[model samples]
Target: MTWEEIAKAKKASVDDAIPSEWRLEKNPTANKVRNVGEYLDETLPARENSITSCTVTELAGKISRGELSAIEVTKAFCHRAALTHQLTTCCSEIFFERAYKKAEELDEYFKKNGKTVGPLHGVPISLKDQVNLEGIDSAIGYVSLVNKPKNKDEVSNIAKILENAGAVFYVKTTTPMAMMSGCTSSNIYGYTYNSYNRLLSSGGSSGGEGALIGARGSPLGFGTDIGGSIREPSCFHGLYGLRGCSNRLPYCNVTNSFAHAPVLASVIGPMAWDLDDLKLVTKLIIDSEPWMDDPKVPPIPWREVTDYPKKLCFAFVSDDGAARPHPPIERALQMCKDALVAQGHEVIDWEPPVSFIECRDLGASIYGADGYKEIADECAKSGEPIVREVMVLAGNGTDLPIGCSHVHEHWEQNKLRYEYQQKVDKYWKSTAQQTSTGRPVDAIITPLWETCSFKCEDIDMFSSAYSSTFNILDYAAVTTPVTTADKTLDSKDETYTPISDHDRAIHEYYDPELFHGTPVGLQVVTPRYEEERAIYLSGKLRDALSERR
Candidate 1:
């Protein structure tokens, strides 16, 4: 078949998977749907909506005790997710019938044994399309990869672990072409819009998972990150996302942009609607002991750290020296600071010892080491043209891979990264001098992005200094939503001065009305490989903010 025929056939197969009753009378366009959750509330039965709103921990308890059957919970989510996909274009693959059958099998097992198979038994889990599943195509937004499915032997370790823990895989979400853009769109599956607003982007490359979770279609989802792939979307959609250190999670057999690019390794992590749900899935995955099968995974069991100081010392930065955040983001940071102080925690000002811009540039060089050549080769395999979103991020506004030809340069880059890490570690230790508790700052809070949301493909490619810096440092970080953009209170300030040309452009584009109601979030970061600390502080911040309500 010609490349065009292959693209059409691939899309047709996904379309065929949808049930006829779920099809909309009119196809949704860019400005058609505003709030997908609201749409489902008005259209779906009240019982189904209530089931969808239950948290993962709550659903697990009810399902395990037999008060609620797995079949009932899975059926409600499948129904709600169907309508969510129709309105948001968030799904790349769907199989609700098979999922219901799987859920029924779980119910039968519980009835026979009087116990659950695992903690997540009967729970439906969504995954990014890059995860290799047996007999399912993991196209990852590339037309050339649409028809080739992985064999059973080649499935990812994460999928197998989740399956044993009783997770029923029913759907895979959309991604941008080559997973290279900050917004979701591709030649294969088109575009995925934000769940709350049609005019705004659902931040990528894990954006499809974000949109699905934001719409309450998936209680727990998995997404991979090399840069801000996991964190950005979670912040944009008001969810919890953890970007763990490299080699911490099971990441084998997953499709990625580069085959063996070695500078900055990608990490696989989870996204959830709430902090408890996030910690629940994270602990379960670690408790499975993935290191036994995958060599890349560290042999670390789940460890609980229960020693947070009663009077903790905290530090935060609302604006990175590079760019001024939009008003909503600034307000979110202030809310976090005020809440932390009110809870008997002392807050201080902090600027990292390392330069975010320099580290981010090194990260980009690592990503582009082989650059567009790989993406071009994949596109050539099917003669599919790269989408505008991918092209706009391709440095010079075209589809050309960068040339990183110096091996010695890469070696030197690694050395410089280590130096930066050491300097930052020293600075963190010195913080005890200023703290009344005489303990180093527990965690640093910062803005997740320069803006709450952006129009598709209109964002600056180099705007990742705030989020990607943590990736470069390999520090563990988790994002949690604080507030939403309010047009009345988060209005524009005309007295701001531009920090740079890029900052000037971003500042000039601010419109309070356009971004009103968009979610604003911040990240709590700990040193490398301290995911336990990250989780503890994130929950603390969540509790502090909850008290304000």
Candidate 2:
């Protein structure tokens, strides 16, 4: 079949899942609407409207108290998600009927047994296209794989764990082809626009999840990150995104870009309306002891703590000596620093432990582990031309997969990654000497991207040093939105000069008007395998920061 035919059929399958009663009477995408949530509130029935507005914590509490039924909550989210998809084309698949059925079952269990299903009993959780939902296709934006149901063992453990704990699944969001771009786009489902701002990108790989949550379509969703797939979208869409050390969550059974990437394996994490939901979801997953099912998962339980010193130390990284952040991102960093300092925390400049440019480039090389052969083969399977956003970055096919000739360099890449991790680890430990609290700095706050948002395919140069370097170091990190890219205050400075050619190219795209009102966020990072502590402190910092409110 022609690529166009395949793409059309895939979209039709998704559209067929939406009940005609829930379909949007008018498409909102054709006009200018600043806030999708406000539109949803005013347009949807008050019953559905109120249900979709509750946060995960509140929704769970409401259900547990018998104030709201699971079916009502699920129906509300499904309808809101439908409206959100109509406005932004954010979803790649929809299974609202199944979600409603699950909700009904939960309600029946509650009526008969007189107890909630689990911690997330009635919550409507969404997922990225790369995450398998049994009986449904998790194609991850490949037309060739459309309508192919995932195998039982091939389903992600996190999905199974969440489902077992009473979380209802309704839809899977869009992802870029091979999940390799800085913005989400593909020949199959098309581009997913930012939910808040229509003209700018929603962010890549996990962009669809970001847009969905940002619009309040779903209170919580999951996204995976090897580089900045999870965090970038979280930052752009004003959600809390968590990416922990490898296997801190479960990695088994998800669809991946390549068959194997043990060298720098990607981690699955959550994106939510607030830190409360983020912490709640992480705790539930850890409590389930996922290591039993997927041996790759570390047998670490969530470390619950309530006490933290009032005075703490932090490292602020505005740039990695490669791509300096644009004015808005820099302002966001400053806002974070000022907020912490005002609350009596010590904030200082941090010269990175290793060359970010070197580590980031090395990281990019690792992404091509199979010489793009896997993604290349997938694209070839459907004759789908690589989308513009990722064509130049990943799929032009310059490098070949592992071969006898390339064995030496492949091994060397592993050595460098290990060495880089050690250097950063040592540097992190050395911070004890520089802090008044007499411990290594609690966390490092840095820019997620150079600017708030960009137009489709506007990026020419890229670096994931700020976020990916943590992936290399195997640290735990959380992205918390700090402020917005307001044209009035985050104006570009005429006297500013780019630090590098790449910096100049990225900086040139910083039009405050274009990025106005887009969310600006920073990454709060902690040492490796410290998911519990990382989330705790990040939440503390988030609460202390006035701008975050």
Candidate 2, residue 135: lDDT: 86
TM, every model = 0.97, 0.96
For each candidate, C-alpha RMSD in Å?
1.6, 2.0
Error of 2 at 43 (Å): 1.9
What tens-digit string does per-residue lDDT give for candidate 2 at 405-445? Answer: 27678888899999988888888888888888998898988
lDDT of 1 by residue, 481-529 (tens): 8998999998888998897888887788789878877788899998888
For each candidate, how many residue pairs have backbone atoms clashing (under 3 Å)?
A: 1, 0
Instruction: Choose the strongest candidate by lDDT.
Output: 1
For the record, the alpha-carbon RMSD of candidate 1 to the native fold, in angstroms, is 1.6
